[model samples]
Target: MRTSLQFIFLLVYASVAACCQGQEVTISPDVVYGHKSGLAMTCDVFTPEQDANGAAVLFMVSGGWFSNWSPPEQTQHMFKPLTDKGFTVFAVRHGSSPKFSIAEAVDDVRRSVRFIRGNADRFEVDPDRIGVFGMSAGGHLSLMLGTASDEGNAESKDPVEHISDRVNAVVAYVAPTDLRVMAKDAPDRLPAYDRFPALEIDAKSATADSPIIFVTADDAPTLLLAGAKDDLVPISYSRNIEAAFEKAGVTSELIEFENAGHGFGGEDAKKATEAMVNWFVTHLDK
Candidate 1:
């Protein structure tokens, strides 16, 4: 005989296991996209069980420049909203901080896009209809993909490098737009950033890494979701970038949650998720 709480726990666990065992989506875990220092850079692919819309979304698995891996099944809930809409999702993990700098992480993710694009047919997705979504440091990387992506080098020896990295749409939550400002002010004003060695970049590197610095007329349509009360990343970052996008005649929108902090909750989180799905569906049309 087991206690009610224990019985309920078992039921929940069983349900989760069933979900990952190929009920709702087909998950291909630990797919290596690139390598650094001999370690493989990887991403987990989640394809809907039915009615896949032929579009793809890449979710950056980053926080404070640190990328961590978790069991792919555990992340299904985070991607359910998109997957349910028949969108294939990629959980892209970049080279992490302390071991890898922000620049390296950017390169890793860019290579991921190239790899995915090069093998789009294998995944049953449109090579040109990819979108990106992330939050916090992940959000910053998402913006980087949206603003700084480029056509591939035709002369590159690696075949993956011959495919473009450009994304069609982007949704970033609580992202830092300007690394230059962060490098100059974050050390003193936001000492919390000091623990992440990736933010220790020099002015030139900061300028090169900042997403706002790379925005152009050809950039992807971007949707920025920010918390008005976010202390970790100010809302002004989103506002400024939105203004820049407007000036450049790029399609961009900013939505701020007044009562939220660095992360959203309850209705704010729900609203943000809906906005992201809608953005991708609109911009990544087949």
Candidate 2:
């Protein structure tokens, strides 16, 4: 009986230790209604317990611009490790394409950030320390939210409308930088690409929307992770963005894994998580 009790205690202790080992970031999903109409949009907020004005990360999930698929578990888990390290994290959901236009989806993501920043007091997040994170389609959304800042509708009376959507840092994994161009380059996607409207990105708009195009001395710090073998988003896209950051004298780094492809899992995913944590620690620590 003594041995059995000891074993049970050990198991419980181990469980509690694991839970308390790193920073305990809690994730909660909340709904943010659209302006004028109460159309509901959901965003997940990951907050650190006992937080003292720590930085925050607004995470977006990947879904190929389709609302039919609900938010993935991976999206919330990716930000957990970060919260363990002391950052409040937010996993935001936006309107997807087809059901909603891409522009409207972009607006959704932008407002999600604003909502978080606007409620910093309730979340115990340092509004200035907020950053952005995303993978694949979410990666594309993160880039757009971080780079394109001119589209916010300042006339709205919504409480979320008054918050600034700008982010201090960015961590993107396999994010599509040049969407229209990438679609043109992809053979498999080309046949199925009838969903979106004509690719009408003019040079100015493309330059404005592309994260790579927005890299400048004034740009926020960024970290990019990509798979070298990813046929979906060529490694060159990351390279181009890095090059632009370099040209503009911005701080940025790109990590490419030779064996990984598309989405990472297991060890590769672990490495990606560590890289993300380090990036945020370096930038948000201040």
User: By lDDT, who's the top model here?
Assistant: 1
Q: Which candidate gets the maximum TM-score versus the true structure?
A: 1
Please state the error at residue 70 of candidate 1 in Å.
Answer: 0.4
TM values, all candidates: 0.90, 0.78
RMSD of each: 6.5, 9.1
Give all candidates' CA lDDT scores: 0.83, 0.65
- With a 3 Å backbone cut-off (N, CA, C), the pairs that clash in candidate 1 are none
Q: Kindly report the root-mean-square deviation of model 2 from the true structure over all alpha carbons.
A: 9.1
Predict model 1's lDDT versus the native: 0.83
TM-score of 1: 0.90
Residue-wise C-alpha lDDT for candidate 1, range 185-284, written one tens digit per residue: 5444476556667787766678888999988999999999988998778899999999999999999999999998777666676677778889998998
